[model samples]
Target: MKRKINSFSRKITNNPNLPAAHAMLYATGMRESDFCKAQIGIVSNWYEGNPCNMHLDILGKKIKLSVINQKNLIGFQFTTIGVSDGITMGTPGMRFSLPSRELIADSIETVVEAHHYDGVIAIPGCDKNMPGVMISLLRLNRPSIIVYGGSISSGFYNEKKLDIVSSFEALGEKNTCKISEEEYKNIIKNSCPGPGSCGGMYTANTMASALEAMGMSLPYSSSSPSTSENKKKECKIVSTFIQKLLERKVKPKDIVTKTSIENGVKLAMCLGGSTNLILHFLAIAKSANVHFTLKDFQKISNQVPLIGNLKPSGIFLMEDIHKIGGTPVIIKYLLNQGILSGDCLTVTGETLHENMKKIPNINFNQKIIYPLNNPIKKNGHIRILYGNLSPEGSVAKITGKEGIFFRGEANVFDSEEDANKAILNHKIQTGEVIVIRYVGPIGGPGMPEMLKPTSYIMGSGLGKNVALITDGRFSGGSHGFVVGHITPEAQSGGLIAFVRNGDFIKIDAENNLLTLEVEEEEIQKRKKEWIPPLLKVKKGYLYKYIKTVSPASEGCVTDQF
Candidate 1:
């Protein structure tokens, strides 16, 4: 840690070009010695509101300590909005959730480009911020590093593991008279005990794991529990690792490649991550300017086995994954089995194969990560269905427990609120296909996730009997026979708009079909009668987002396709 004066510090250009810029920095008490050091930007998502990103400032401090105190580099921290999906779920407020990703990306790009920092580090939490930061890094194409905010430890109630999902479903159980109001209150009190991301393999944790698997993050850092010593150590470890990445001139474009995107999909499939991962990764690939397709995710899912035993689809939490050797063991086991490609270069400035060599071998006795031959499922947990309803495509999380196929009467709801009410009132029949629509990108104006509704059905003891399909997306914690992201979404005049309450709908996951079981003439007749909704957001971000955002099939991005 000796200050060699002009070693790495001299890398900064203190050229006598702009006196105002120099004066502004110096007026803040930046000494000449500090000016001589290389400048690094820390795009931090820190806020006092929610658990997901509350501790990001703490992580930023650790990162700055390494960059300035240990590596003799000047680090500047910038803050951005980190919207809480958990806080906004099931409300009109949720409409702003997905849109926050765009703002997060734009903010970083604006700051980093304006500052012209040599190296950048993004510390993110929650569903949107993680991918948002990565997209910004990809756009900048600078020497960059991404550190996940990490997972929250699980809470327990009556010796049973409880997390945010438990609280969400407990309400449904109370309404259905399955659980008493007293028990529901107990769940609300105990489900999420402290600060961290939602304690499940949901979007936040899913995107974190996906980023690690894709080589955007330092290996094993993504699994560290939030606010733990391990997480703080991870933040400190990153300063040195990122410096190496900077020294090697390794950009995000170098680390995030076509193969790497596939690797991300593989991890998502195995982990049964939120369907939002596909949307975020698609946006990430678009930002990186890599030619990745929605089908590409399906292709990788076909080969990758569902290995991680983490939930809302499984028993363990992400903290469980961290205890049993972190994400590297999952990568190493998959790579060893020839499922994941070892060729993708990672931020470690080495190939994924060499990176896997650093982590300890998977504990054979460990229950978190299972062996290849005896997987949680024979194939990956995710599936893509296409038929009359979703002509372009749709997504489904097919846990082996939900039989391969379902044929039931369609019970259509124009919105999630109606569907949610039906579950509580026992109005939704057991053999019914709940169809929630008009909530895609342009529809909901942000494509708010349907975690609440799906969790409600499961908690009401209708998970095995009922099937829910929507033009919206699902939270990673949403399990059961749920399908989402129906392409050419209902707002865009898709066939899902034509589904009537009494129509017989069938879902064949094994064959990848979501048929309406109606005649083509009927569909054509209904198409002629159908009229798209005229949404009036007046003048806000939603107004602009509605005008340009693409369909869910296209990642729900606002690019001018």
Candidate 2:
């Protein structure tokens, strides 16, 4: 049946009126409502001869028919067909089995080549999807625009409005005790109104924000809601921008320079952005053949202060950011301070300095973005530390922290699962360093964020006092004194492999040190018996991921040297 549908689709593609220039490669992880609303035509293209239907499934039940035809389909053969895949997490019963980053990158390459695509607009949200799409665009090196599915409208809970991440944390806490299932469902529904971006400063939203700050997206593109009329307008604008980009022969490399990446890093720090940005930015810089390291982040952090009052750091949403002039304002601030590369070009066909001039009367009032003089926190960059525990250096965010930057006994958990179990059992004590190993690149394989444990630590009200040290990365929304991305991971016999339970660990962000208070002889003795954990994926993408995924310090990106 699928073969039949493919045959029919091929026939349609062969029609000469369906010009290749009009062909827009709209790639997305989910079937967004904005995509459905921006469509023009639809037909029952035979999918495996099973008569698979295609239409807007907004309520997940009724299909809103925009176009229908039975006979004489030959006359309307020139009509465009919008491809919407149900690959996002929001889809019912859909597990997070989307293709790997490299696979998706290759797929986009194939799409651009096979379709002879003149222009492309990517609709990507969520952590993995954004980077996957961005990496693909970078490889394609074509005239492309990323249309982010924006954040959902704020949801109300307990008579107070709450964002997605906070809502989830609240739900997880509420579930621990007694709560009506119906109420939980209501909160879930309220939290997610429609097709949109992820709730927190998780990798998905943070990457979008970084892309915007880096001048890869149109103005206000990062925060527009997926269901808003403005979002539809932005899609049209992106389509138009793609045409312009093609006409001007603007490639991805034109916008993604080293300076542009520096701009992105500065913005990420100011917003107290996701730790995932560290990995994604590193991967992006690698694709561009630009040399960037974790140490560079530490250097940049010393100059840039955390100004954006967003979650995990402060109380604000992306919408508020949009209202306060967005990246343009932030860039202007950095440029004024002689911190940003003013010559960097943006998607708007203007240099970073030139774009700032376009915005009129930008305000830096305390309610919106705080000024550098009165920053929410100073030094927003993720710090890199090295010692006996992480000989090759580990990453940590020290922005907004208010306690002593000192050492504590390591309560090591070999994996996040063990750490979480201990947290749930209340075995974790305050001021003790929580060491989460085996969750690094080769450990979790993809290095899934150790957010669950971090949240549990926060929810237990010990977040202010305790410190989290892990080989894995944290979400952009994650704050506090959390150390991540211990390089030469335990799986590869890095220094983290020598750590034992109750070992004294020291983290001095001020001095850039993350050392285990153990003698060199004792560490050498443990290294002899320290066996690296073996990954057993024999087939599929996970196998490729395990083989190619770099360490957290290297951005955890796959297939790149």
Q: Pick the candidate with the highest lDDT.
A: 1
Backbone clashes per model, in order?
2, 6
* Residue 26 lDDT in candidate 1: 82
C-alpha root-mean-square deviation, each candidate: 2.3, 8.5
Tens-digit lDDT string for candidate 1 (1-561) = 333333332333456776777777888667866776667888789998988888899899889887877445678888988888888889888888888898898899888877777778899988899988998898888778888888887888878889999999998888878888888999888987877898778999899988898998888777888878888887877877767776677889998988898888788788878888888988999998898877887787778788777888888998988888788888888888888889999988898999988777788797777888888887877888899889888988887888889999999999889988888888988899999999988888789887899988988888899899999998878999989999878988999989998999999988999999999998899999998888837579988888888777778788646
Candidate 2 residue pairs in backbone clash: 1-47, 1-48, 1-49, 2-48, 5-46, 274-476
TM-score of each: 0.96, 0.80
CA lDDT of each candidate?
0.84, 0.62
**What tens digits encode model 2's per-residue C-alpha lDDT throughout 1-561?**
111212222333445575542243223221222221212111111122110112112211111111111111111101111211222122211111222445555666666555444444565545555666677677767666666656656677778556555644554465454346676666666764444554445556678778887878786667665566655666544444544565466778899988888888887777777776777787888877789988788788788887766776567777666666655566677778787887987776777778777665558654767777888766665677887677777887776554539577888888777887887788988778888877667766556565567666665666788898887666555666788888888778878777887888888888788888888899889988777777734566666777777777777666666
Candidate 2 local distance difference test against the native: 0.62
